[model samples]
Target: MNISPTDFASLLCSRLCHDLLSPVGALNNGLELLADENDPAMRARCLELLADSAKASANKLKFFRLAFGAAGGFGDMVDTREARTAIGGLFGDGHRVELGWMVEEETLPKGAVKVLLNLALIAGDALVRGGRLDIGAETIDGHVEIVVRGEGPRIVLDDELRGALGGTAGDTITPRAAAAHLARALVTENGGSLQISPPDAPALMFGAVFNAA
Candidate 1:
């Protein structure tokens, strides 16, 4: 699948907007309710809801900056701790999901970081029932290996996303699967490969191998 840089950027923007719509919309609605509510206690609850929505909006922007934009410093490597914080913030506010960080490297190449973040995003979404997400990455023998696992009572991965991750989406690509497509593109461009667990598998998992040097 070949896409122009402009088209790819548009797809990413669309995906970001789609993910942010709910929280942003909630923020708007909360403000309207707060303005109309006269009861002190109810107004307090509205304020709380507004705060929660604001936090969610901020978290999603932070996550997208690193995952889909040219964030971090000008250096070739990005701090893994930043990645951990971004992931935690995006999925930890409501405490619906658990995160397990297994990477020991202090910093990773920007390409690897983006791939890891995007994979984590996909895995986190697959855990529709709010499950545990484990993310790990390491560089060994000039190769960077990334893995993300999502476990829950029920896991669902859309076929389009699976195909996009495997680099077989062909002409059926959509904005929703843009992150998976980006992950595959980054790995393949770095002379590596991407893999995903079978759809029937008990757990959803993603694996990628790319040159680190």
Candidate 2:
């Protein structure tokens, strides 16, 4: 990519800022609650709020440290097992985001992992009523594909998300949308295509395809 040191640093910092935005918001909320509270009972509640927020932030940090952070270590080939686990962990104990492995040992760039994880997180948000999610990838005859599917009651397939996935212009994406947008950009940067849609089959799908040129 011939990226300069300054550009890469800026990218890394921007990525961190995007991910930590939520935890930092929660931190602010906790501080507000602490300030408004009185008495030992209320103080204990505030402490619990602070603790929970801290734990959530910590979990995200640990997961992102591997998925996006340098700690997972950078490489052209990313471990499928590690990427799957990292995404699942970041989504946490609520929704059921399943990985249906078809092609084992499929490897992609580190940025690919980060993008997929972020997209899955957005899809998870869309399936608020709890549903089935499918995550898998394949590489055949110099071609690669990754698919993320969600099936549930409500599928939040909005315009902004579609624009980001389709590489079109749209409103400024929120933190949640940033994941999917970045995923699309990552895939495109690698000469791949991203397609996202809500199926009449009651599914929300995010798929990417890369062909050796």
Candidate 3:
């Protein structure tokens, strides 16, 4: 789990680029088709596709900004509403994954928010066949606790990612695990602990707790 800061940053950049490539590529392809199409109906379809792609790209960027970046210039604390919006946009598309946000705090420390978002991202992705993603967070006695649960017909939590979240990825860390590594690092830095549901369980759940005092 130990890596140079520069290398870790490169991994995060790779992950962001990989996730964005699909929608961004679709936008480029749609624009090209719109330029060449003669039929009005086909042109309209291309435009619709372009719009969807743009929205998807934007949503992913927003999620990553909070989960991995500087929170879009936000201060030491970030509004919970922004985190909710980002998660909704990332997983609420076409109801592929339903989101249930239960965080009551209006704002949380930046480190806590990042941990929450990254863990939610991991849980959401585990629902390979689409399902429910419930995220809950709260502060008790100056400590932040976050829990993300994903239940579906099929859940796929990559071993590397699980290891990363548990701070045991060792030399197998990759771009796909960048978020998990970062989450674990932040939690540990703040004297926090993480928990992952057993692999045989029907659902995937992640819980994190860190000192926010």
List the candidate 3 regions with Cα displacement exceeding 4 Å: 72-75
TM for every model, in the order presented, reads 0.97, 0.69, 0.97
Where does candidate 2 have its weakest 10-residue lDDT segment? 1-10
Arrange candidates by lDDT, descending.
1, 3, 2
Best by lDDT: 1
Per-residue accuracy of model 3 over 94-203 as CA lDDT, tens digit each: 85898888999999999989999998888888888899999999999999999999999899987899889887777758899988999999999999899999999988
Candidate 2 local lDDT, 10-59, one digit each (tens): 66567667767887788888789889888789889878878776866777
What are the per-model numbers of colliding residue pairs? 0, 0, 0
TM value for model 2: 0.69
Model 2 has an lDDT value of: 0.67
